[model samples]
Target: MKLLSRIDIRQLRILSSLLQERNLSRVADQLGVTQQAVSDQLKKLRETLDDRLFIRTSNGVIPTPYAESLQPKVEHILAALEDLLTPQTFDPRTVTRTLTLCSTDLEQIVILPKLLKILRREAPGVRLAVKKLELDQLSTSLLTGEVDLVISNPDFAPPSYPSLSLYPEHYACVASKANKTVRKQMTVEQIAQIPQVVVSPSRGDFSGAANSWFEQQGHPRNVVLSVPTFSAAKACIAESDICGFIPARLLPDARLRVIELDADVPGFEVIAVWHNRSSQDPLHQWLREQLLAVATTP
Candidate 1:
């Protein structure tokens, strides 16, 4: 407890500078502190955090995974400290900036309508840009402010980023109503026999989100098709004997019918994840509130 208390604001500033500058001497020079002073602080940070945090490279120093994770959080802490002196104020109607969101089609179909209504009625000048969800680019895009919020299931957010649960969602085993072979319910063994279609937008891989759960039940998923979008998967599944697990909210389609599983698939929470730098910013604050209102309302 005492060791952690030694991590004062100056050490945090040094940590941030070192993460960006990636050079001990350069960080020291930038912060107007001695190289030894920086090293002493780094040593303290390592002990307090219990992570090496950085390693010496030929060029200078590169942050370890633990250190990389801390970068955004440290910046947020610094930002919050800085915000204490500079007051922020804004009006929703007067705002004229576009907020970019990284999300999947599921969110676009389910959440965006309500959110757009609120935006149009309240913050008319605020434009919204939603890009396709790319999980690999999530950390970098958010850190650089290329994306404001990532609306997806909980698994996609980086460990350090802040997130709010927009809504709860569960999957439904769906197939074409035309699939006569399957019925209203199927056991794990029965469902495993059928070839399934999956949605993998960013990659051309056979891997799926629920494959492991199926495998745990002693039936490795036999994925016969992988499509880029839910609509594509739906079209394919609706026509063929193949099936998929899709969100329940997108159902009741004339072409599709639900296939109940005895052992239900676990649900996921759709969250709006954002970098912490926007924590105190009024635009993000107001926008998150509006999103929460729309998502949580019955």
Candidate 2:
């Protein structure tokens, strides 16, 4: 008989749970089993693997080197099996799972509160974890199960992943409510003369879509500050003589006033991107629907 054949997949699941929960009793509670049952599974797993998988500690348990090495593989296996066994019909009110998403702080500020409010009322059992979206790493993160959805500009999404347009990212100029240089409306030339606080997603470059549009129109902005997020750029504009072009949704700030610019800066499409594997998944599809519903609201 093969040594591996002696172990059931359930035993590996216990080890995986142990890696997360650490305490045998906690793992039992999570799995809806008893501590003695978890110990039996661990004993079987240790016998099959020929190693002590966990060592008792004052807190609970610590994984041995061998068990640590098995952790990722075990997790991947369990996730795959769960997906395979997942029901076609999903009940958000009853399902308990965390949906991981990738987004920027600005998007989180604009979108998460509304979405979370809806979830809190409708799907209390579900949880969300939003991570920062790194453009170059998005494709790999989606394919490798690091993030389930990415809310980003369409241009930044990987072509391999399927996407749905969430909204048009429009920008308008903002300045301190007390700034004397800005008025109800500014001409293209007047707008160009003011020092601009440019939002560069990467935080170092003072260039962005507005800058590109300005150059295309034969007038480049006099950039005096570079910021990483719309919130920061708005704060910079509100506290200084600098003006910033921010998303239209980020308007109505108490300390900042929006200035109507004569120059037209083009807007880009914001999209919700997902891996091919999740395109047909009911849970994922439901999540995308909720995002679309929230994103399109006035």
Candidate 3:
């Protein structure tokens, strides 16, 4: 059977590291190997690949076209291998580590406040980094450990990672008090006839199940404005006659009134996701528990 040996893997890894650091000595130090060992590996790599992968210069080694071409594939393979070998176990009480989370702005505004408070009291040393992640990259981001957890609407397909439903949030049609067109309640037909604002993170089009509900009810709303965030939609609603659908939990402010939809629109299920390998991790488990607790609170 044809096989790339483990030594080949090690050599590729070393080559990739050297390309990144641009200094053989630094790469050698990181790898805990002598500079001669790195040079010997580089020589074997050049023989195996039959190309001058790197050109030595006065400053440092510069990658040849061949080396540049191999960088991405090598990095991906190395990342995948590293992910495979990463320890899944974690101890929250003993471990002082940062957990990276990917979530939407609405979720960050609504959920993270309480979660941060709890974390500060419970795990004082642990840190958190929250990044806005677009829906298209959610699955791969979780799989690759780009983010430890993703809090997203469960309507989107559950990522390859292990996921659990946090809570259900219903859609509400919101309008400013000054807008005389919509009152406390809006029928499906009435809502469809009004100028609407749509919120979508990816396409900036109608969001969640709103489009599906409109189509199912045989009435499509005319979307006058499209924005990338729920807050933008709410702002549009507050500024004009345009009404938009948003999560029910986002109703703390008095600038807009959330009206119930006459048509049966499906509620959004919020989910917390983590890599399958991290399902048993104590830190991940604690984070999930804290998030779930915050979600459950009235």
Candidate 4:
């Protein structure tokens, strides 16, 4: 088999579209060309491949066996070519662009406030939209351009995208003053037995570092309820015996008492992720720097 050239691949894509639509006119409409243009391209495609790539059937055009076999390779090559041709760089200060970021509520509550403040003060023209995405979807979203950046737990494996650790935060058990059992610190067993409000922000299976530590010591926690937001869990904890695992840095003025976990649960890092294609773009670079500075500052 001969190696397909770039022109062959482009023609293959046009042929693929015709196969999908069946009607030459419809394919031409989609491609912003006339029916004659579509027919010409189809002729070129058939001659180049030396095969009837698509055959007109009663319903529509049907791809031949050869075309069927080449479809996957052709699609992959065209996608790669599209990526190669797409412009990746962005300029923050000058570009009036909206960047979509996927992150948990924890990042919204802790990091986004400061980050947005910096954007307002520095990059007034830039707009930010934040969405809460499940952990499983982060990598796919980055690859598909559904999200421009992802701020998530360090435990999440960095995808093909470039990522940087924004900051580190320790886990602390927080409860209301009215909760009599946990005043300062609670033992592993005590923590296990308590009515715990688990915060699974990303619909992640593991509860948190504190829960992981307890389970590692052969003591699994009795999570009474699982909430999506740390604030909601905190609110639930403030009114009842429910205790929540929260980031240590989130302990300033909330009406909850934060106690260090008895187990040596190491702090987790927060990461800022973006596609390598956009990593060096001036706007993305500036936004990343602002996020890091905000996350690290006291």
Candidate 5:
């Protein structure tokens, strides 16, 4: 307790800002402190913590493993302190805040367009930044305030975080309009024989959600090509004889024909995930509400 008391809250804020800003000059500018003064504070923090919190890098500074591990706890501590000191109110219309979100390309394509339209009207001053979703690091990122929200499959979300079902994910097979193998209706045998363009989001991985479903149903897929994103899969189907599986939420391109399969394709829920700490935050809650509204509409 005595050692902790020696630490200044202002220094803690500086450390937190460093994680976001990465560069000393930027942090100093944001905090209205000299670069040398920020360096001095970092020096004091390093001595107090007995760890080199950040190491100088070509781009800026990178947090040490110890510093990286401490980020979520520090963010929680600072947020709790701020909540205690300030009135709990967020005026979306006038507040200028940047919200960072992580999501797959599919969700970004399906969700962001409508959400951005609503935000333009409802929260004109708010800004949004979207980062590609890194599933393994999402939980820690959310807890540390590195990302404000995550839109992804429920299975990918950490169990510790609170999640709300955004929509039920449905998939359909797509093929070029010129492909003769695909018709109005397809049976298991016919679908199995046709070459498939499987979307393996990780790129190198050979299997995906649709592949797993095919396995469970005792059907074999001839995966002619493996791609990383829905757009790529659709493009492959549009140009080639091979068919691709795509989430139903994505509108069908006029060039590609949607193939109706008789066999069942397993569906999972797309979820909006966030750390429990932000569950009651006005901005967070409002964002979730808007996402739910967009997801449920049509």
Candidate 6:
């Protein structure tokens, strides 16, 4: 260890160049130092290594067996050190790592398709693994590097982590086209009286955000069923005479018709959240930018 401690990068480079050029004057000019400077460094190298690495010749110098044996190892060491000193850069085009995302089915349905299209085109090699949002395990997963990003509305976003707002989401009252109870246009009172399905992805209760909005206006919605995801709720509402609040982005499907409401519906902001450790990560930042663009896109 002390033998290596006495040797430094400057001497190593001088040795590397001297081995290649086999001449003191050439090594001096190549390293932008004088022949005497090269001689002084070579002297130090010889003392540290306990071997006269080269033999002075009338023409220049010839490498000894010990110096010849070190040529490959010295080159390897310099290359490794040079690589270690360089800063890492992110290039989406060449990325091949899998990015694990945690989000509810609503985001997986409404937001992920648009994001995937961009990813497939720009970062062809970057794979994606989507995990359903589990509130109880979210903080541990995020902090332990198991989850890369979380996409959710304010109600579901983890309270302890910082988040970036992607966009605002409004809900529309929708009913199956076959449903006969809905009128041409209904008051919130009339709509609240009909059978309703509320989406509560992380909870099993037949309650949801729409209940609060309905209760605020003094017309609590009649909840007949609960589903775990927006996609599941959409499926149930399309086949049954049930009405539920659906995000505006998932509207215009032929299976269901938007029910005109006499009252204004409430909306929430969607956001991307991450642990503080990833606040400056290039991949996370890029993903957030893509999500923002996708959510804001027409």
Local distance difference test, per candidate? Answer: 0.87, 0.83, 0.79, 0.75, 0.84, 0.85
lDDT of 6 by residue, 70-117 (tens): 976786677667657645787889777788998888788778999999
> Among all windows of ten consecutive residues in candidate 2, which has the lowest summed lDDT?
200-209
Candidate with better lDDT, 4 vs 5: 5
Better of 2 and 3 by TM-score: 3
Query: Compared with the true structure, what per-residue lDDT tens digits does model 2 show for residues 1-298?
Result: 6986887777877887898779999999988999999999898888888999899999999999988888667766666777788887878788677989888776798889989998898789889998876877888788656799999887678987799988888887888999997898988778888999876665367777677788877778899888777888887888889887888787778998888877676888888998767776677888889889998998
TM accuracy, model 2: 0.71
- The sequence of per-residue lDDT tens digits that candidate 4 reaches over residues 1-298 is 4534525654766765765566777888887878887778788777776888888877768878887787556645655666677467655556778999988788898888998888887778888889985778876666545688998876775656678888888777778878888868667787788888777776744465566677788889887788777778778889998787778777754588876666666678889887655654567777888888988888
Per-residue lDDT of model 3, residues 16-106, tens digit only: 7877788898899999999999999999888777888888988879989998888767766776676677577655556688889988777
The sequence of per-residue lDDT tens digits that candidate 1 reaches over residues 138-252 is 9888886789999877777787889888888888888889888899988988888889988876775788788988989999878999986788888899889998889888887
For residue 201, what is the lDDT in candidate 1? 67
Off by over 4 Å in 3: 1-91, 157-159, 206-208
Order of candidates by lDDT, top first?
A: 1, 6, 5, 2, 3, 4
**Residue pairs with backbone overlap in model 5:** none
Question: Which is the leading candidate under lDDT?
Answer: 1
**Candidate 2 CA-lDDT value:** 0.83
For all predictions, the C-alpha RMSD in Å is 6.8, 5.7, 5.0, 5.4, 2.7, 16.7
Tens digits of lDDT, candidate 5, 83-104: 6775566777976789998988
The residue ranges of model 2 lying beyond 4 angstroms of the native Cα positions read 1-84
